[model samples]
Structure formats: structure tokens, C-alpha cells
Target: MRMCDRAGCDQPGNCPAPKSPNSPERWYFCERHAAEYNSNWNYFEGLDKEEASAREQAERAEGASYRQSSWNAWAGPGDGSRSRDELRALEVLELDPDADFDAVRKAWRSKAKLVHPDVRPGDEAAAKEFQKLQVAYEVLRAAEERRTWKGPEGTF
Candidate 1:
């Protein structure tokens, strides 16, 4: 086990403290020393108001992505599916990302008909494919709604 770097201390150094701002070197310290070091830490000491605010906002946005997701799975910024549901949805409908809603609907209808349970009765694979199409349509529809939704003041 590593010993604390604090002078005259013999405790196990379980916590790591950075030696300097943005430096790779680290100082291992015991819990008490670590707390003492952190108490004097100033993350925005050298930044101006605007710079500090921008950095703080960026950090919050990055960390909040985890909390914003419906589940604790790793999903992209929008449409909280663990997988890349948006791209997968587009692929399912055989449409490109730039395709409009009309194109999405058209493609979905065309492909869906081929796998639809009613058209391919008793075919388990086709039934599964139809389900995929339905899910893809739902994902795209929700995304479109989010893009167009205006809040209480009619502003995004």
C-alpha cells in the first residue's frame, strides 16, 4: 500500500490529489489530508466570470446526461434508448437522416407491409420484423415532436 505524501504522516494513501491544476503528477494522501487539500481547491480561481460560467455550464451539461436518461443505460443525447435508436430507426425505415417526416412515413409503410403480421401470418420472423418497424416509427415520431415542440411561452 502507498503511504501518504503529507509530511510526517504514516497513514495509507488511498485518495489521490492532483499536484497542480491540469498536471499529470498526483499526490497520494490519507482521508484527512485529502479533505484538507480539497478544502483549499479553487477550480475557477484564474478564470474570468464569462469563462467560468461557460466552463461550469459545459461540465453540468456533460454530467447531467447521465441523469437525463430515462434509464441508467448509455444512450445518446436524445431519445433515451441504450442503442443508437435514431440511426437504427432511420435504417429500419430505409430512409436517410436528412429525410423528412413524409419520407419516413412513406418508407415505413412500404417496408412495414412486407413484414406485417397480417400479411405474413404465422411467420415468427416477419412478426418480429414488423415489431421492429413499429418501434422505429415510434422513435422517429417522438424525435420529430421534440424538434417541433414549443414550450409554455411558445418558445423552445
Candidate 2:
């Protein structure tokens, strides 16, 4: 037999668990009291709207930082100063402007892998290189499509 912990309740039964977040180990309340306690409980009761908003923003920023950290961790390292445009231009030249779709795609994939930011996390150079690769791939792909659509000797 146990006593209900709520004040003014003398009924003998199992003591209800405490609903207070502050003293979980020491406090206990009967069913009705616990319900009341829970209804009034507020984790952010004292915070003003601005304060709450600021806290939320801070939390969001922290989350972004953590995500960046994780991304960097996975990416390993960053290239020093290579630019994406330069990489793309080099790739375009290497693949040959006249290369077919398969060749172009293969070249783009190889270049992308070599310069992807994730592959070189902290490297500004890698980021630049990767951008170049993307630009080159896009330009080449568009040109190839246009050439195909034009057909042999401008025929429909």
C-alpha cells in the first residue's frame, strides 16, 4: 500500500510520479495534481518573443555549422587556389570540342570527381576547379545538343 502524494489527498494507493522537471527524484503527485502540474509546465515560460526568436536563430546557425563541419569531414581537404573556370576550360580542350556525347559525359564525370568540393573540403582551389568543371560540362553539353539538332548541312 502506498499514499498518494498530492496535498490534501489521504487516499491509500500507488504514489503518482512527479510531473516537475526540476525535482524528478524528490517530488511525486497524484493523478489530478500531476495533470494540473503538466498543464502549467512551460519550458520557455520566461522568454520574450525576441529572446525566443534569437535563441532559435542561434540554434539554427549552430546546426548549419555542424552540417558544414560534417561535410568538411567527409570531403577531407581543400585545394589551395585552383579556379573552376580554368578547370572547365582545360577539360573542354582535353575532351575535344568535337567529341561525341559519351566522350563529353565521361570527361565531365572525371573532371567533376577530380575537383568536387566534397572531395577537397577545405580547398578554395578545389572549389574553383569543380565550378570550372561544371561550367565546361554545361557548355559542351549545350553545344553538342545544338549541333545534333542542326543536322547535316542544315537539313530538317
Best-performing candidate as measured by TM-score: 1
Q: Encode model 1's per-residue lDDT on 20-41: one tens digit a residue.
A: 9889999999999999999999
Clashes of 2: 9
- Model 1 lDDT at residue 81: 40
- What are the TM-scores, per candidate, against the unseen true structure? 0.50, 0.36
| Candidate 1 structure, TM-score to reference | 0.50
- The candidate 1 region of ten consecutive residues with least summed lDDT is 69-78
Q: Pick the candidate with the highest lDDT.
A: 1
Local distance difference test scores for all models: 0.81, 0.60
Q: CA shift at 20, candidate 2, in angstroms?
A: 99
